[model samples]
Target: MSDTPTEKPSNRPSPVIVLVAPQMGENIGMVARAMANFGLSELRLVAPRDGWPNDKATAAASRATHVVEAAAVFDDLRAAIADLNFVFATTARERDGFKPVRGPVEAARTLRAQAAGGYRAGILFGREKFGLDNDEISLADEIVTFPVDPAYASLNVAQAVLLMAYEWRKAGLERETDIPFTGPQTVAAPKEELHGLFGHLEAALDTRGYFRPLAKKAKMVDKVRAVLTRPGFTMGEIKVLRGIVSSLDYFSPKEPRGAGYPLRKAEVDKQAHPARRAEDAGEGSDD
Candidate 1:
């Protein structure tokens, strides 16, 4: 391995994630992980439950030690976002007072613009069980609400942080690249090759009396063709399927059928339901 140590990017401007009266240590660590995923680094906690410098939080953070280590603790919301120029409070429910509400994407764009003007921006998240109270929300410049189900709008603290972080990163992107296909590169088989394979398989099945009941033979054949044509098989795939059909045709045991063999209904029913034959024979003997 190379001797170079992994370096974190410091070029982009990221918003400060403020957790107000957060309850669990695990949630703090998970929030750190989510922040790390979308390139957000700064973390501020206001009155976290179970105390600070928690081992559970550290463990749950996994590889996001940088976020957990640099986390700043504050006594209240105002102290946590004292230096920020703009603050957004996330809430699921509507409050009594009128406040400008923005979705995650809009909030991200606004934060980006504010940061470009050399001003620090932060987002406030509430407690897990009860979200931000009316008093705490009044401190924010704008309200941010997720467009989720009205009946069940509550989101986990870490999940809310992740969604906002993802939007922030996405809004900053110039363009996105198409997903690369990793499997073997093969072109679709020619029409002639596909037709030959279909004919070969159908011929083998016909010899085994698979297309029964002359009236339904056309429909059954069409269904079989539909299944085979759905995948748009490649030349290599078609060859493999042809080989499998050839092997089955050669190795399968075939009973000799006399010339001009009549199609019997009883034989067809017995083949369809083998167990019913015994019951039918017993009933016939009883009669």
Candidate 2:
């Protein structure tokens, strides 16, 4: 394998990474590099201490000049997030708040759902010295705290940003590439297939009265869709899911149903998916 880096990523519906009151210009560059590494290009700077047009940050960004050059400088956090429909604040310190707290993975999933719903979202990263203040954190609708040791919870601004960026990319890759091995007939379920899956499952659930209370049905469906779309399900996996849903909704196992639901494509058995079987055996190793 070549040692060169790549991926001049295209524009996508990704969360805007907002750095709030960053202190060091070099750290800002490093954060930008981290974002670039993870295919995130939208960068927002809010009242950096050294001010805008920092040469040090741009120099530190290495090849991520595009992200640095396109970065938007905002006077304040409110103005920075004014156009965003949802926001997540990253902080290590525990504080009193009614907002929901989640890990990076869950936050990434929520961000993806928000993007799918055509809503802009952003994540706030605080100053390198002391994380986001109580007031700043309060501005965010949700909190994303890293699962670090409680005794030493603090992380460098770049490190914190890198963690979130990695999770965000991982949530999307879903075994598409960047792996040592891949399963046979590994086809990433395209956005259309995912949307189709959502429509199918939602319709099935509706017939079973799964959505309770008419007023909250939309919100409930949104949450369910988020969970379903969280996994990078393959095309085969999507077919299996649709087939399972069809069987449950239409066929009666106890009664005299002639046959179970048939998938559009022929089903592959255990022998056809050795990679998945390997993954199943290796579950919890990373945890």
* 1-287: candidate 2 lDDT, tens digit per residue: 22333332434589999999999999999999999988899999999999888999999999998899999999989999999999999999878868899999999889878877889999999988888988989899999999999999989999998999987886765342454344455557898998999999888777666676768999999999889877889988999999999988787554233333332332344347777666667854666
- Candidate 2 residues lying further than 4 Å off, grouped into runs, are 1-12, 176-287
lDDT of 2 at 256: 37
Error of 2 at 131 (Å): 1.0
Q: lDDT of model 1 at residue 192? A: 97
Top lDDT hit: 1
Alpha carbon lDDT at 142, candidate 2: 97
For model 1, the local distance difference test gives 0.86
Clashes of 1: 0
